[model samples]
Target: MPQSELGPLKSRTPSSERAVPAQELRCGRRLSGWVLAALCAALLGCQPARADVCPSKDIRNNVTNLQTLENCTVIEGHLKILLMFKTKPEHFRGLTFPKLRVVTDYLLLFRVYGLESLSDLFPNLTVIRGNNLFFNYALVVFEMLQLREVGLHSLMNITRGAVRIEKNPELCYLSTLDWSKILDSVEDNYIVANKNDRECGDVCPGAPRGETLCPTTTLNGHFSERCWTQKFCQKKRCDATTQFGEVRVFAPFALV
Candidate 1:
């Protein structure tokens, strides 16, 4: 990946001062804070993009462009860092978006082979409003072959749309979260084809009272795991309380 650091903001010399060459040019100096605001707000999407602003288009690349998002706190659009191929997890180890708090649209991660977890990359992300979605889903993590976890530890709410996480061969920490804690409904969400929970050594620690952390339900009618993570797995029983809010957390036969 090329080192594409953000360029320094330039000062705008007024047209009236053009005749005075001595005063008209002042290179290397940046505009004041108010002028910088005008530079972005006055000509939105124009050149010399703000270091903290997300790209106007969907974010994509093999490198994830961690450099471009130097001070970003809120991504107004979808946040999709994808297709980081032929790389190891450590390439992005020390790199992170520590200031990011919300992705107003959706978030998707696909074919990121080296990424083992998201705990560091988006450590402060609290909400994904899902104003826009990818195939009717707000969060999609697919084909992450080496990923071991969906480690968004600070994620608190996904206010709209469903989740789709599939085809992650080594992924864990899926059969532990209770989506009911975040989403209004888990009926349409899909979580499948990750490492089998039975074989996954990192299976979620059950509830504190020695009860099952999550209700027994088939993931997309196959893998016998329910919920999304351990923190979301607060409800410990699967009897008359099998339903976590509006989510039917058990197969019809299991409920029988």
Candidate 2:
């Protein structure tokens, strides 16, 4: 037969050669699948359970009953934090707990929504961390009547929870580098209001009255006119012709 027409004989060196590549591929696929499965399992394991986030108005008394101690952080007994609604329970005012006595060790924080100010609500609670806290636009004092504790570092408000800081634009009195200074400034402003205006409409009978009716000045009244004229108008305005022009010209500027 011609050499060109003859084909090479099938190599029969070993049967193992034919099966080895397929076996190696099968082993590689099995190993890849196992690695993939392990990676998937690991990813799922690290995810937080739905139970971790408490919803609004759903009060869970004795939270220790719900999850294992390991799953929940134990601050004192079994409760780590008691989540209260800022508004659902009643718009950030605070929950009315007549029988409430928070254990200091077990409860980490009390998160409430719509907090206009954080002064009195958590008087005993020195530290807090949450989302959705409204700035205290109407707060003057931080009255922690039963609290002598220390350390208030974790206090904060966030986006979606009872502790969220939102909707409080008029809370200028509560924030300052020196809160005492801020309090002093607020007190000064309050005194100014009380001095010029009759708040409860209770005029002080013992108040010092000059010649003119000074106590009659309300917050929106001409207070300086009564005060200045009452004290020194007679001594200074004996020359009425000389004073009228001066008084009239400077009257607009005095209004300011």
Candidate 3:
């Protein structure tokens, strides 16, 4: 990706030397990595062109063969389904989905990438059974007023999305949404700070022991170091012992 100094719309390189070495590219004259990815997405027509009918194969089938779903949305509308594995679905740069309005259930769904703040898109969505977001950076920024359940593991699991948890150190509250059921078993994974930013070391917390960076999540949010630790640090009263990495647990807030 090229680094644009002017704006979002103008950091493209010349078509010649398309395979030029990225490091060798002239600074201030190339697009940033993010911009480059977006350009490729545009050139390849990665986003959906039209609403293709979703195949009726089991959702799990598509999970193993993401190659088949390069041009369609997953399950849409009112339905009850069971997902039972950890699968990383590919996200087309300009993917779109149908407006969901259903009282559905996604039980035992292991991991998902693009299902960000879905509550806003599906006002009637209720009862999301056993599942973990794992990583969907855009979801961290979603406004799911009714979302009460999330099952994210480590920060590494969250590969992309927009909630901006990257710089927020005091961010412990993963979601402001309210769901009837949410599992809190992921109180032992390390959370990653703003690893993408150059100034991250100054604002972000020190990395877990033995590691040079914080635990990984879908690291796109602009959260502070305090906000990140405070939100996910476990609140259990156990024998405090220094562990190898940052603990993924939350304690009650006390302004000390």
Q: What TM-score against the true fold does each predicted structure earn?
A: 0.60, 0.18, 0.21
Expressed as tens digits, the lDDT of each residue in 1-256 for candidate 3 is 1123112212222221112121322223443434443544667644322223333322432333433334332222112112323322233223322222111112112123333322222222222211222121112221212222232311111111112222223222343211111222222222234223343233223434333233333323532322123123212111111122111111110000
Give each model's whole-structure lDDT. Answer: 0.57, 0.21, 0.25
State the lDDT of candidate 2 residue by residue for 1-256, as single tens digits: 1223111211111111111111122112323323333444576543221222222222233433223322221112213333333233134244322111121111222332233333333332211111121121111111112111111211211111111112222222211112121111222111111111222222222235533333232223333321111121101110011111111101101100
TM-score (C-alpha) between model 1 and the true structure: 0.60
lDDT accuracy of residue 248 in candidate 3: 14
Cα-based lDDT at residue 60, candidate 3? 35
Per-model clash counts, in order, read: 3, 17, 55
Flag regions of model 1 displaced more than 4 Å: 1-57, 203-256
Scored against the true structure, residue 241 in model 2 reaches a CA lDDT of: 11
Instruction: Give the alpha carbon lDDT tens digit for every residue of 51-142 in model 1.
Output: 24454234455565656666765676787776667779778788787767667678877777788888777776666666666656778887
The alpha-carbon root-mean-square deviation between model 1 and the true structure, to one decimal in Å, is 19.9
RMSD of 3: 21.2
